[model samples]
Target: MNVSEPDSSFALVREFILLGFSCEWKIQILLFLLFTTTYALTITGNGAIVCALWCDQRLHIPMYIFLGSFSFLEICYVSSTVPKMLVNFLSDKTISFAGCFLQFYFFFSLGTSECFLLAIMAFDRYLAICCPLHYPNIMTGHLCTKMVITCWVCGFLWFLIPIVLISRMPFCGPNIIDHVVCDPGPLFALVCASAPTIQLLCYTLSSLVIFGNFLFILGSYTLVLLAVLSMPSAIGRHKAFSTCGSHLAVVSLFYGSLMVMYVSPGLGHSARIQKVTTSFYAMVTPLFNPLIYSLRNKEIKAALRKVLGSFNII
Candidate 1:
């Protein structure tokens, strides 16, 4: 018998074809308009927050500083996914493997950073309300800067090992990613080989970051609520309610969707349902943030009025 060396090279998939939401022509048209409008609003809303915080001196406190950084993050965060989604709504949504990996990396990193930033924000509120006497010292400029840097650094670094490992896997099978964004679960599922080790590691790390930061935010807010209830003036109580209510709403939207997605590997949701769920948090949340914080809070409203008043629009 003729001796044949084992086939050394495996057929590799060069790109992934993303089967986004609906296949109907009418529905796709509607979705295209919907996603386009949503992206515009996300950019405008977050950009406004960032500019307001930067230009106004009065809103330069620790709370606003963190908010500015968060708004900037939101801009980057939504941009990482929405543009591709917009284009996909109209035509074939094919992305190269390298492009898909970059999307996954930025998307995860920014989302994780948001979780940590939200916790830091809650801690800031707790100290301001419960430990007023020491709040200034506890949250100085340097410390706030440190917290921001840590969030960015840790967020970008958190999933590096898992992503690199996943990317290196042999994706020599099906090339269809059955969702809107470049999610890790879908990407991993396409590999020619099973990756129990990488899967376990990624899931464990994701759960830790999500639940750990969420719990910290909850604890901080509980103490803040207690301190707010003990405050003597009704005006002070109303102010706290306004700020805390907005924050709680944002937190719930973010974590609720995240838990459903990442609590287990895939949870067996259909592709359409997954797309809608992902869009709710990833695309819609950023649009709502500026509306919630600026329009509801009397302080932010006043600051915006002061700044915009010079143009006489208000």
Candidate 2:
């Protein structure tokens, strides 16, 4: 196939226009307000979690440490997509080719990092529950720091390959991105029309990263569930289940929407469905994660009280 240059021909457009939820003025205003409110709450909720974990020594455990990292990642993840989308709703929807690629780069990096971080959290739980005697020695402070670093490094490394592959393709024309954010799927569709080889490479690489990380998370959680069930004491089992349950809920929400958005058959799914599912992970899930753990966990509740009491003294 003759791949047309975006500059030379209309085949690959240099800039793609993102068609936000509605073309109507009233709906756009409403969406802008709604999204703004959600964004604010997400920031506050996640920020509180991070702050409480840092200030309170009691929350310095392995699980809380991981939760803090996850909260921070959620803030990054939501910020990358929501602000841009909100801006598009209020103003011009067109984004330059380079701009779109950058958006995908950050979004993909944070997203892939979340996947690995969740898996690491599961592993932490496994050791804490199944190997309590060795948990402290195994998941030491240095090891936790290294694990967090590895999550970020591995995530960026995995997504960078596809971003590079996608960037090399020339855009000719027709620069409208079908979805809210600069998603890889719609981005690849444009590439397919112009450069089939690059498109295939991007698709394969993205699929591998998404699927590979999800399977690892699933497998880790499976063993965790088994270990939880094996505990003799009822209280032990309940505590173990409670600890893993919140994480499991988050893992399911993150991977479920991701799989639906990327892995499922795209034949019958509408753009609206795509937008909604994308929001689940990009907007709603981030907000839910901090709330879920804080609400369910006793230590976090106590920390929040202490933090609040300290603030009152000032």
lDDT of each: 0.87, 0.83
Who wins the lDDT comparison? 1
Least well predicted 10-residue stretch by lDDT in candidate 2: 4-13
lDDT, candidate 1, 1-314, per-residue tens: 99986445657778998888867989899888988898898888788778777878988889999989988999999999988988888876898889999999999999999999999998888898899899998999899999999999999999999999998888876788999988977887788778899999988999999999999999999998888998999999998888888889899989988998887655687767778889988998888888888888666667667667866878
Residue range 244-282, candidate 2, lDDT tens digits: 899889888888888786666445578789888887789
TM-score of each: 0.94, 0.91
Candidate 2 local accuracy as lDDT? 0.83
Model 1, runs deviating above 4 Å: 1-9, 306-314
Off by over 4 Å in 2: 1-7, 10-14, 192-194, 265-268
